[model samples]
Target: MDNIRHRHITSFQSGYDPVLEPIVFDEKRKTKKPFRISSIKLKNTLAPALATIRNFYNKYYNIIHPLSFTFLSFLTRFYLISLSDVVMWDESHFGKFASHYLNRVFYFDVHPPLGKMMVALAGLLAGYDGSFNFESGTRYPEDLNYTFMRMFMASFGVLMVPLAYFTSIELGFSKHAVILVTLMVLFDTAYLCISRFILLDAMLLFFTFMTIFCMTKFHNQKCDPFSANWWRWLIMTGISIGCVSSVKWIGLFTTALVGLYTIEDLWNKLGDLSIPKIDYLKHWVARIICLIVLPILIYIGCFAIHFAILTHSGPGDSQMSSLFQAGLIGNDFAENPLELAYGSRITLKNTGFGGGLLHSHVEEYPGGSGQQQVTCYHHEDINNDWIVLKPREIEIYDNETDVDVEFVNNGDTIRLLHLGTERNLHSHEVPAPLTRAHWEVSCYGNDTNGDEKDYWVIEAVDDIYKKTNRIRSLSTSIRFRHKVLGCYLRAANIGLPDWGFRQVEVTCDKRNNPKDIFTHWNIERHWNSRLPPGGKANYKSKFLRDFWNLNVAMYNANNALVADPDGFDILTSKPRQWPILEVGLRMCNWASDLIKFYLLGNPAVWWSGTVSLIMFILTLFCYLVRRQRQYNDFSPVQWTYFLYVGRICLIGWLLHYLPFYIMGRVTYLHHYFPALYFSILMAGFLMDHFTASCSLKTKNIIFSIHYALIITIFWYFKDTAYGVYSPNIELRGKKWLNTWDIVD
Candidate 1:
């Protein structure tokens, strides 16, 4: 009866008439089964699509992970082969300074010793094993190893990749984002180039990143702002910033930015206090002391070390007393008095300001119009525009040694002029052949009107003999034209009638107008009034004079020469110190270089690694430290992700400006890169937040697509090795040998 009743209930529960049949209970057999059967539902309805997606992701992920990271990192480095071989113009200058330090010479470099010191350290560790044997007339150090020093920088470059990856992870980026950011840094060409070279820029960047990381971490960690530990970190940050500043003054801008950011953060915290204004002010004051005061102290402290070591005068003492006496006033309590008293004169021309130093000078040539009594003041007070070789000029010539020279020949007398252009000669037109009484001249044109043209003339006079009945006069005129591309000079000759005297005049006109009154003769040609029956005339200009003028103009055009009327006094002039100038110059170069890398080089990967690493350390430290109090204050994951993205943007922007920095000192790109990258990161974070509020399916799809794109793009570029060129194999061997010798 129960079974029948159950069967009736089951029949009612079942739907359609055909499917409504109830199952009978097999009581005797102790088993029960359904009367109707149906196919099982599949776990994944879109299995085929899912399988395809999975396979795609698997392939992409496999290409970029583990071995891919190593391969890509190395490939990026390899592409910088030319960078190692070329030895940029600036590197040579730095090498000279390093050599000076090694030889214990009294040298004065505008930049602090930290960067050069590192180079010296590299040299000491890896330089040749032999010594200078004056008696034997041989240098004991037969091998001048450079590979180890280069490798040191290269290692720094490679380390940035891992650092960036960890930083992204720490910043709370999703696994996919972390991977994306890491790959971006690993493949950056600019970073690879910088790291492979023996320059302070890489060091400055490393320290800058470090300072940023430490400061961000401190802010995130909501510890007692006045605590010793907090102060310690602040001090460390200050020291690092100072170290960067020591290398280049441009680092000061970053320092200032960080300082302001800290103050603002503190100000906001104080504003939120509910306590009495005075009490809050007191707390704020304490915060300032810890954050601001401590940092300043640390900076000064680091500087003090350089001051002492570089200024020391006696044997076994590295005090830079001469620098102190030469106007590095204000000393810490620990400074040595004797060292200060016997200090060396710190002149702008050279740190060793004694007699025989090569002070800059200007040699005036005939300006445009060739005869305008235009006075080149040669005064120290001339502004940069009028000064011709001002600070900007110094920046231009700071690293240039080779320059372009153009020569042209007119049929008659040869005129030579020197034209200076930043363009490499290797790409431009070569010199043409000069034959038979031809003249060549090179000149500089300051304007299209030729108002400020300096011309150099080289003339070749031909020997002529007349027969019994005929007489003739011959003359040559040399003309020089200056243009933005280069200077052009041409020489032409005119014949005088038989039995008559001829006069030739070579004039330089300030105004392009050949008929202008200002145009006066620089070289005048005069012949005897009458010609004899069988007389002969001869004239010629030698190669020495022709080559000399070309060389001079080349130097002048490139701004290699410096002129000072009042001796070295102008060097100490405001904003004119070599150190200050060097800092500004290097900073500008760094900014420009970053810009170029961002646009024309590898945008995705350039400098991203170092930046990512720095941000990761900072974000991680902040998350871990602030976990207790700020557990619910802000989402750790969100903040971390924001920082990770921010790191990518910051590095990307910096790398983009690199080329500009190398070519010029000032540019619009410098200001834009930082702003653009920051905005993108902020916007992306906001989007992420908004997307999280949508349905799970929507979120999953969006995330999957994002992941898929990043993975695919990274894989494609990684395999293609866009920026990875041939490795500087020579540099490797050189650096390795140097390193081994130094260590040994």
Candidate 2:
């Protein structure tokens, strides 16, 4: 078309409907000298060939789609997968998570529980009995049925092709576009490699694509808004939301996409003259129930299942309250519950958003107000215990204060007496163990009782509205606000060296962010309880309270997780570089005998996707301009093409890709998979649009070139993508980029 050299290209190429373009290949173009196929025999032959393609579409389309889908699924299971045997990359993390599910060992992960749960389900179904530890670079156990697990994940990966294909058809894309979408996923080397690994990416992507697929199907039923199939697809979209969201919080990106579309759909419906007000109301309520309420219930159900299965305490226990821990079987808190009163000696434990306990060691600071180092200890020790001491004046007047068995009530201003060093928990002008902006809480001067700086007012958040409420057993979350310095006590979650026992650093900060768990402390072990003899733990009330505490902990932990200067991430990629396929992330390898799995995008898909994106923008701009100049002047296929390819897919891609740039977290190339999916679909749009006007011979040539290139590239990269190779082979003969290292 470009070589034909028209005098001027219109807002859109005229007379090119993707649906009929292949059928009417004999139609003459308005080029400088119209492109001609003067051969009578060739023209005669083309009719039968085109007629055969039309007949296949009209008669055997249904059979072909399913058959093609089956073949792709089988190919995915047979090849791209089942190539690796030993543990690779996140398999170590997720495989252990699966084992924990089998053993009922509760653990923590940044992602939601469903993906890991699915992984566990896959392993269980495959006859794995939670035996393998799945340590990094370690070989999987002999009896482990890894193939079934891999095949299970491969099934989800292959399911994406059909979803995209069917969704494309529903969106009114050309037959070629639908087929191209399937082929795009089939030949994507990175998709093949990542899906094969025992990770959540495969499931995450599957649910995400299904969510989009259902969304397209739902919207495609706009004319039949009251139809059974419409409602079915709508509800299925909501369920898909729950499925995808429960895999990773990043699924929020797709959720947001759906939300915006829902709003737009409703707004458009409301403006429709045919839609009565009552009908619009009915639609609104339906979407609210399906999209909002149903997804919420499903999301909560997944979490409830997560909590139910993980009954025993494991590595994640420290991140939860001791009261919450009491609910778990075979944990210390359940077996040994402690209560407390005034003058009761207790040790405060921080749930590890940032880890450690309220601790003080004998080691002094390097310089300035040198004393026993006050910190948060990660481990248990006798030195961590502190006495609930009254004010300096009350210590001498025992009769006045009754500093004996009287419970330390909420809002009570008390000084902590470090049992090991006998120094008041002081917060003065001295620099803290870490985060120098905060004041130090050091056991200064080695005094039995200290000055005003040492006195801390126990302001129990939400629990301290009254003075009568006492610090009871396994309850009462309070914050120590320094009276003199006027700053809240915090577990900085930063570790200090020898001076602070290399535990989490503790300090008093001027900032009192209510969302932060670092400033909140639960009286883990109070010596006096109101509960009668043989009283059991009230887990229902404790869980409700711990749920709020968990959110706070999650907030702090997620905050701490991002932008950690001490924790350098070599694999992390900037958000901007993702679309261009600039780099690769090395998954794992052992020095002795390496078989590295790098997280890299297929350059062919990534680069072509980028071009398609640019084309989408250019076409959109032209479409908008044309609409403005002559309203209702849209081409036949133009608006329909833009509906799925330009607007929805682009928005989905942007939603997944753009927000990561604002995040301070260490992100990698693998994070781009969701956006990469949209990009592949966008490429489909370009293929359909550009080829719509091409001659039969040119179309054949283009398709053949792409097919050959994809095959050649996939074949060339076979070893790196699938084979677990040794040092002897030359797998880097065509290292496309210097960064693309086939390390095995």
Candidate 3:
């Protein structure tokens, strides 16, 4: 059968010719038989029949050419369906920027504008209102509008399916290999979820794939490496790489890998056994020009375009200068002495005090009889060995009463519950019975009681009306105690019974009152809380410190009682053009900007990481064990797999783990997607090897099982096992074991 197939294929070497032969097949044997024909009959009947059959087969299957496989793979994978019910968290932020861009607002996003720009284009086409604000807007009733944005992102994500397909095809992947890779990407929940959002990961992956595709094309072509036309492809490669970088800096790794691959290709082409000194010098210069100079020029050219558009200035205008200027003039008040003296700086110390300058000295009078003048301080004592600066609080209680309260430490779960009851309660219809209450609470560290805790208190109060007596009380209060310090109160009150009324006026004692100390109360709804006052409610007659100053009259024995509990008082602090809170917010926005690389997900744990690590080690062992295998005898796909896997290990170690350990930054995940891509590629090569050198069906079953497992693992854990949102939630409860819980 094999011999007959070979002969049949060989007969068409000069192009398909059906004349002068009659093709025959043995029905019983299920194989092609020897062909025999008269010349006249072959020309008239056999020739046309064979040609018609060939044309029909090619047209029906659409497999007449190799590129048809890529087209078909793309078509099948481009279903562009929405993934989950809720938009993933990060998509909301990008959707806002895209909406702003469509409204012609200047949006200085931490990420490049391309992804959001694309989303905005989709929104515009879908007739979305330009005034819509994602942060404040309701998602319902406008579900289709939001879906439009997601659909746009998902479509771009599906593009990766074809991108990988064509990329594999260009690299000489088998038809099965191409289909498998495309399906792998399609079925990956992580990939699909990310694609269905207005995030830059899909865009970054798309451009990186394009860069790889262009490089593969260049490598396959025979040309003068130094020729202008030949170098055009190299320039295109560099530009594509730059586009990836523009989306996310992590794309630089892909660029570097491609650059190294190009240099290796050039070195192979040289084939120099031993060259004279002068010829070696000449070759060296040309290599440097092709590898270094040209790539740099192309990279800079691409960056120049981005710079001009983003900065409103030309290149060489000082990249560091703009960042510094933005830090100084754009947002940081500490940089300006005048602003520091009179401006407001929000600190962890002054959470409750108004967040504006001139808060501390606003109430100063000639004598001590005036409203106690609020004072500000630059530094405060860090209590309990924790780095948080202690804030001051003042309380005037008519009397103390037993109360039950709930506390939360790291925003994970409950820690402790204190139980109590009220006296002289009559009816059995009381809102809360005079029994010990069981409350769920969470605690962080200790204060003076050796159980330093942060929590919200819950209580039920009874009321009497003229016509009828009813039992009702406000549910919770924010509470804390440390050393000689104690603070507890309803953070914000909802409507509750007070004697004969449905509302009550809650006020705090007057402290060192400063001039320009503006007070206003804000009632906000908790989106995720489960109790009453958990949803929408209102606050009445609650004093709000609009601003607080920490520098006016540093916390001392005399003014300590008047200080705000949360430390730095933004209300008493003088107003500044730029404040510290804004700076921190900007930094957060900047750091969070790294989600574009898709690699910014969580580090693989004991299972996924360990399995990949073992596979990598085994691949290394095999390569070392089979060192006798010549380069040519090994398929380029196999060789590439080895190179790719080694690259993955090297890059993953440097990019994902090292920064986290050394710099205290976990930005490495931004570039980790390449590791996954290369791992799958290695698996493909391994399957190919087993099929070619061993049993085909056995290898197929094994690979199919392995692929199924990979998919299952990713699917099961994709929600909580990876990405910025995942590990954070899982580790939220394990705060004792994680020092990195400060992210919230």
TM-scores of all models? 0.42, 0.84, 0.45
Error of 3 at 182 (Å): 2.5
lDDT of 2: 0.74
- How far is 301's C-alpha from truth in model 3 (Å)? 7.2
Model 2: per-residue Cα lDDT over 1-744, one tens digit each = 435332332336745332212112233563234333353367787899999999988898877885777686567545745555678888899999999999998887777788999999999999999978999777777799888888887778878777777877876777767776777777777787778878899898999999999998898888898799999999999999988998888888999999999998888787898888999999999999999999888877777888889998788777777666767777555333333455666778764353456888788787657876788765567788887777876753242353444556677888788888787788888777568898877886544535788888886654322234666544556788888888988985676765555577788888877656778876654332332321234322344455555555665666555655667676777888778877777677624256656566667778888888888888778877878888664566667646655788789888999888777667778899999988988888778777988988887788667767766776666555665455524545745676655543
Question: Tell me, what's the RMSD of every candidate?
Answer: 24.1, 11.9, 21.8
Model 3, span 1-744: residue lDDT tens:
334332433445535564443356677898765565452475787777889998898677424433554443344323333323333455567666655655453333334444556667787877776565554222423444666665666565667766667666666665555655555655554455455555677787777667776776666553454466556766667667767765655566676767676566547546765545575566467546654666555545543433333322221111121111122222231122110000111111112321111012222223222321222122221210111112112121111233222222221211121111101001111111111121111122232221323322212121111111211111111222211112222111111132212221111212212221122211111111122331112111111110011112111111223333346532221111111111101011213323211211222221233345456678666776676664354577767755654553345334422332333221322234544555444444444444665466775676577557655654554432123333333434422223222234
User: Which is superior by lDDT, 1 or 2?
Assistant: 2
Model 1 alpha-carbon miss at residue 276, Å: 6.8
lDDT of each: 0.37, 0.74, 0.39
**Can you tell me which runs of candidate 3 are displaced by over 4 Å?**
1-87, 124-129, 140-144, 222-232, 262-613, 625-663, 666-671, 695-744
**How much is 434 displaced in model 3, in angstroms?**
50
Candidate 1 vs candidate 2: the TM-score winner is 2
